[model samples]
Target: MRMTISTHDHVLIIDDHELVGTSLMLSLRSEGLRADWRGNAGGEEGILADVRRLDPGLVLLDLDLGRDRDGRMLDGVHLVAPLIDAGWRVLVLSGSSDRVRIGGALADGALAWVPKNAPLPALLRSVRAAAQGRPVMAPERRQQLIDTYHEQTTARSELRARLDKLTQREREVLAELAQGHRAQAVAERFVVSLATVRTQIRAILVKLEVSSQLEAVALYRRASGR
Candidate 1:
């Protein structure tokens, strides 16, 4: 079903999966609400443009919108503040279990969260509530999610600062290691001796304050979102 609504009372569903998005939109329509959906088939700019045009009452945003056509990751959380600033109320509806990302969206002015796997009745009710400007998420749970996001973001900043201590070559070497490449392979790829690679690896360890290559790689993945 397709809808073209310019009213502020409409609901918008921003999700990557077509089946999920379309089904949810249809369900909302069944309950006598105007709902629209934007998928990752288009670029971020296109999605936001359509959203601005719709000017919906509530946005059911997915935290993970997979990737765009250019292979760049497209997350709905990135749209939270932009939409909120434009006078839109957002309600996150996603399958992502990452509390940090969820909390980040909530902190960015989302009204509440409803799991993608939630039962149909519950999901519809939550959508209806959010469209009416009521948060479906519990207060304590909302605060907890917001706090987790802040804590994780702060820790990631500190980790990023430590990573900034690495030299250009050291950062490249760590990137290879983080991909599970052996130090020798990294040395070969960089056209350097194994000893030179070992030195770079040691520098990375010291800078990241990790005892093992695995720990350093984990930190790198966490900080870089790999």
Candidate 2:
């Protein structure tokens, strides 16, 4: 499976599985691409150290690192923001079939994503495309990204229009909810009774034209773009 790309396209693989990384490295070298492997997705701290030391032109990453001490997901989504912020090109390679996870990673700034089951030639194409600064994504995933962008745009427009329909109390409730507060917590913070908070929340939901708290929150996030 050895197929190398180019000497200049130094690649670093961040995956928890040693066998997978080894196979990938060998396959990459076979194609003339210089590839190296690391055993960890590198907890946040380790990831920083690896990035600083490797300084690779392309990074192939696996998202599911299981739970660390904090019980947080260490998937590609978490890595995307840091990698992009540091100006690194990242390609997500994972066995997971979670489209939501894939979408989140792409939204956060991954250059490409390919399922591990993809053909070797397809993987090679993605690696080369990524090295050349071209986006590589499954057709369905690409469509999902477009749909998500459109949904957010529409949600934001709706949110803005709804804001004018909200009362002062409903706006206050929405603001706190948008900050990730639960209805109960918001009730406590505002020193309002639980029933009153529930009523305000229902009003806010109506004003936002959403049926559920999650929907309202999503609309708020889309409007805020954060």
Candidate 3:
């Protein structure tokens, strides 16, 4: 049986599948918690409207918002940043097992990512913990996030050190190249001669220790976090 949710319901779920949403809603109700579900058709504006109307304490979100008319999966990552900015506590419940996707969601401020296949009791524990504003990452996932963070930090530091070797003019030239500007366009933009721009490009490659202009640009983007 379906439960009638009121504004006092503290939990709202956003999922693409009606069956899954209904089932989860029923399960949460059985635990004496009021909950409601929204389908993908609600869109971001609709979801925000619901949030405003419900004032839910916690939102369980799915990352995949279902397929488009062309059958491509609609990404829901874009919704995460705005939800975070709006002060919504989100817990991601998804079938996706991709570490990068899970990590990105958490990095984007999701409270937790509970694998859909996890035991119902475990999922309930995560929900309760999130509702209470507690840390919800499992041990293994926490370690994985830590390792990923360390790797990114190390890579960024190295890239910064390499970039530091470039002169101001060379850095400017590299920035232009990173934006897909050709040598001629960079020279024109900087009001420098083509030969001078080429010279700066070569120096940028040497200082960045990259073999080609594209590699230098890639390094610049990595260092700048672009």
Candidate 4:
């Protein structure tokens, strides 16, 4: 069945390629929906400005935002959470099938992901669904999300269990270390000797079942929801 697209369902396409953005914008507008295109994400401020001005119902986002000033790939995944936080519904449209990237986008609150290679009809359907606040995901992608959630939950549970075994002093040491404190600094903060701080760090690592101080600190941050 054909999905009904409302005229008020305006969409913004953020793609690094001008041709791709123009093509998508034209196609979307042809369907009687208001559509616009921006060739780059333009960073947080720029994107937020565009969102405020256009008030798009949905953003059809390309995950690769081309290169940054540093020549690194400007990952659009970083924008998903901010866009959602700012009350924009985003639908990821990417050619890359990297599960980690896809999973990150889903976890970050993107409404759906439509492969860039998908037929225009399929893309339009996904966009319509997103505009109507209906979430959709491919079965395999859905399973991946489920598995990721379960894994994070299990890890958190295990981390909590490990933390339960920590002494009060050990937890304090971990908190300091997670904040990038050196053993010497921690010793000064706690008025303990450097040796004592190092000892606490070792104990923390053992309790957390981690190999090193860094690992212990990372686990502490994750466990503490920092």
TM-score of each: 0.91, 0.60, 0.59, 0.61
lDDT by residue (tens digit), candidate 4, 1-226: 4346788777889888899999988988877888888876456457667777666478888898887655666788888988877777888999877656666787787877789999988888888777777766766766676467567767778888989999999998888888888989999999989999888888887877889987887788787645
> Which regions of candidate 3 deviate over 4 angstroms?
1-9, 68-72, 146-226
Candidate achieving the largest TM-score: 1
Which 10 residues in a row give candidate 4 its minimum summed lDDT?
39-48
Find the 10 residues in a row with the least total lDDT in model 3. Answer: 1-10
Local accuracy of candidate 3 as per-residue lDDT tens digits, 141-196: 76686467567767889999999999988888888888899999998998989999
Estimate the TM-score for candidate 2: 0.60
Q: State the local distance difference test value for candidate 2.
A: 0.76
Best by lDDT: 1
Q: Which ten residues in a row have the lowest lDDT in candidate 2?
A: 1-10
Query: Could you tell me the lDDT of residue 165 within candidate 3?
Result: 93
Q: Give lDDT: candidate 2, residue 187.
A: 86
Pairs clashing in candidate 1? Answer: none
**Among all windows of ten consecutive residues in candidate 1, which has the lowest summed lDDT?**
1-10
Question: Candidate 1: deviation at residue 62, Å?
Answer: 1.4
Model 4, residue pairs in steric clash: none
